[model samples]
Target: MEAALSLPATLVAKLIEDAERHGMSVDEYCRAILSESRAGDRSSAQAAVINEPSLDDLKLEQLSVERLSLTAVGRTFESGALSGHINRLLPLKIGCRVLWSLLSDEGVGPTIREFREEMWSRVGSLRDYLRMIDEDYARPRGDRLHASFPNSSDAAIKRFLNQYIIRKSGLNAEQSSGAMIDFGLIGISDTGRVQFTEVGRNFSLLSNPVLDEEDHRGPSLSADEQVLILSQIRTEMMREWKFMRHVLDGIHVGSNTPTSLLARINRRYGPGTKADWSASVMPHMRSGVLGRMQALGLVKRTFIENRVEYRVTPLALVILEADVV
Candidate 1:
């Protein structure tokens, strides 16, 4: 039998708009809205159903549902019915006490000790419980693993869930409609509260860009190409002049070349050599250093014998020559 509800026209229009934005059908949108509204009630029912089960059994069920849903989602972990259903249920079922505490006035953001106590109070060892979940979810079904860990930790999972709620509910003015940036599910605010942002919520429909395998080598960028590519880098650094000074100061004091600069960064930050350093530590440095140097007419790169090499321009020497003590 088909179910029907008496919804206001305005609400129906908004739901239709949201469904279109997410590439879901109007029926799917209605289902999602209904599901979200009933999440707490449904969770209560689920809790009642498993109240008598041992903690091990409950944990096993949690792990099983997570694995099955991950499999159903095709290992890519798209935000849909299965993922949403799991998100709504898991925390309430597995970490009900902790969730209750968080809801309570006495619960300041849970510390590691508090978290451990809450987690282990229900189950045996927290690590073993987590390992069980991980082992089952990560086991290979066909070509890919059951569940993917795009971000680390349970806190991250919660953050993702919270973000999903905000996005689905349209809590913010900016999220009226259309695509937005993917800031991951978790965010650490300036005040150090681990919370979800509208940015994270909007990312539910977006694709995860990071590749899984380590050995999958991709294309390389050329010097001119890299320069053009780094326009965003230039704008970012210009926004913070102190960052530019900090980077230039490092290069000026050291005798190492650009290639060796990456090694120096890797010693402090670990792995991926130049690519890692460029993306991580020196994102501002790439175009910041080069653009500033070019503006001051200090450095120039030329292709010689099919190899790109950089040298200090005469104008750059004039400035640095005066600064040299």
Candidate 2:
């Protein structure tokens, strides 16, 4: 037997939104909420307020759907197969940039522009992006590392960090959107100074857990920095394919080729009956997801007798194993 509890319309809506973001059905979300409520002290009436929507909920309500897309995909990956590594990948490149800038400074964090400029210097040039791809992809399966980026300008980077990364990382908007504070990496003081967190330092310091030495793009980068960069690149790839998980899943190790993968993905997500997905979606996925996965040591891409073939790496098998478990 069950009883229906009355809930505010706004609260119900917020639950639905949260459910969607976490890739959970409404029933699952409600069950989790009820379980949490039961675990708390029932004597206190405050537990009931857990269902109440906050200002952030209101802001999300007003914002467009694209802004909130990251929230769902990031969490869904985290909750399932990528459980151990998902936290390291949120906000992808931008998150790593923020953490690294904070780590290098060791005191005051870099301003939004400073961080963006540094990242731009690394991968801004078309030559640089291509070189990174070559270094990352033209290697033994176990030696590849995550190395890719969306073409972006300083203003675009700044906007993405402030408007998207911050919110997606679970930081408040109104109080934390100032220059000094960002997603949990940096904090602001009363005098307007900024300092990074221990969490940020640790994140920036993660050693390369999967890739090999040949995969490291820069000799100057510390092991932790290399790992963080790879994490960011991997995260960026996942975020780009957020809407196309089906295509990713469809791409089996021995069964798909570059041409076939492109065809399969285009059939599903492309502008059907008119524009070629090969002209648009295929190029983006080739450069973004498949290229990055090959670089990350997650997947191996090889040219066999003039045809390209893909195989899952050992590290990727770990993720697949988790999915089954």
Candidate 3:
């Protein structure tokens, strides 16, 4: 049996917050609370716990199930999307958070025009971002700025990657989306919106303005933090990439080129791939797989016995042997 009682806006908001905190639905939370109540009321011992006050100044209006304000949604969305912790990882595109929020909802996500307006509001023009990038590159570093140690120069590079967008060519939405798809971070939903892969969602959120700035900027995060970011990146890469580990392993076990590496892989799998190497499948293994790994300091291309060969980097070896805690 059940009954309905319209809750005050304040109480409903609190209930929603508490439900989310405990990973419970509103009905479940309310049922639990009722179950805990002795005869529908707290005992004398529990009476000390403050009861909900009827404060006129609190804007305690009746709950409206039909419509909730955008500010309310924004508050909930930004609580996770724009939080400081997430803002330090990847330099997210301006509307990335908005895109994510919309995706989290049921219906269709925001249209391209709506997304572009948000971008324009946040960043006036393309040159504005370029100028910010210029500023970032110009910031004085290590010994030069007398900020800290020398060899580790101040460099934080994340060029505002758009998760999914449709804008002018200057935004490079298509190219950015292509790179993300190649990296296996996102996929196209049936509704034509970007959807985060499992590891992609777990990676970490990032704000546009100060994103990746923590890698350098005014106050750098601790070494543990820095390594954590890299570790997460590596984990996500491994989760999505099919050929990276294989290619790296082949290199470690003395396979120079794709033909040689493919031969090695064929030993584990059936035969055929070595003889039937196609660009569509392998797709520039050296530049595509190994090169992306190189960006993460995972592998290096060097001349071995007068032949260009890929070698696993020290960072990759360290991660393989022992991941940093």
What are the models' TM-scores?
A: 0.20, 0.41, 0.36
Clashing pairs in 1: none
- How high is the lDDT of residue 299 in model 1? 52
- Clashing residue pairs in candidate 2 are 145-295
Candidate 1: residue 282 lDDT (0-100):
49
Error of 3 at 310 (Å): 3.4
Off by more than 4 A, model 2: 1-106, 118-200, 208-248, 253-255, 272-279
Instruction: Give each model's clash number.
Output: 0, 1, 2
* Candidate 3 per-residue lDDT over residues 223-318, each given as its tens digit: 343344355445544432335566667787789665687566455433354334444444333344454454345665666585666778776777
lDDT of 1 by residue, 1-325 (tens): 8888689999989988999998999999878879987997899899976653223433222222211111000011222111212211112223322222332232223322344344434433332433443454452221121121114466644453332222222433232211111112323233322222322222221211111111112111122322321232233223223333333444555523556554443453334532234345443344334444433334555556755445665544454444432
lDDT of each: 0.35, 0.43, 0.41
Tell me each candidate's RMSD, in Å, in order: 24.4, 24.3, 23.9
> Between prediction 1 and prediction 2, which has the larger TM-score?
2
lDDT of 2 by residue, 119-230 (tens): 4554344224334555655634323222222345666545544433332133422244421132234443333333344434344334322222323343223445534544
TM-score, prediction 1:
0.20
Task: Identify the superior model by TM-score, candidate 2 or candidate 3.
Answer: 2
Worst 10 residues of 2 by lDDT: 67-76
Which stretches of candidate 3 lie above 4 Å from their native place? 1-108, 111-199, 204-210, 214-242, 256-275, 279-283, 301-309, 318-325
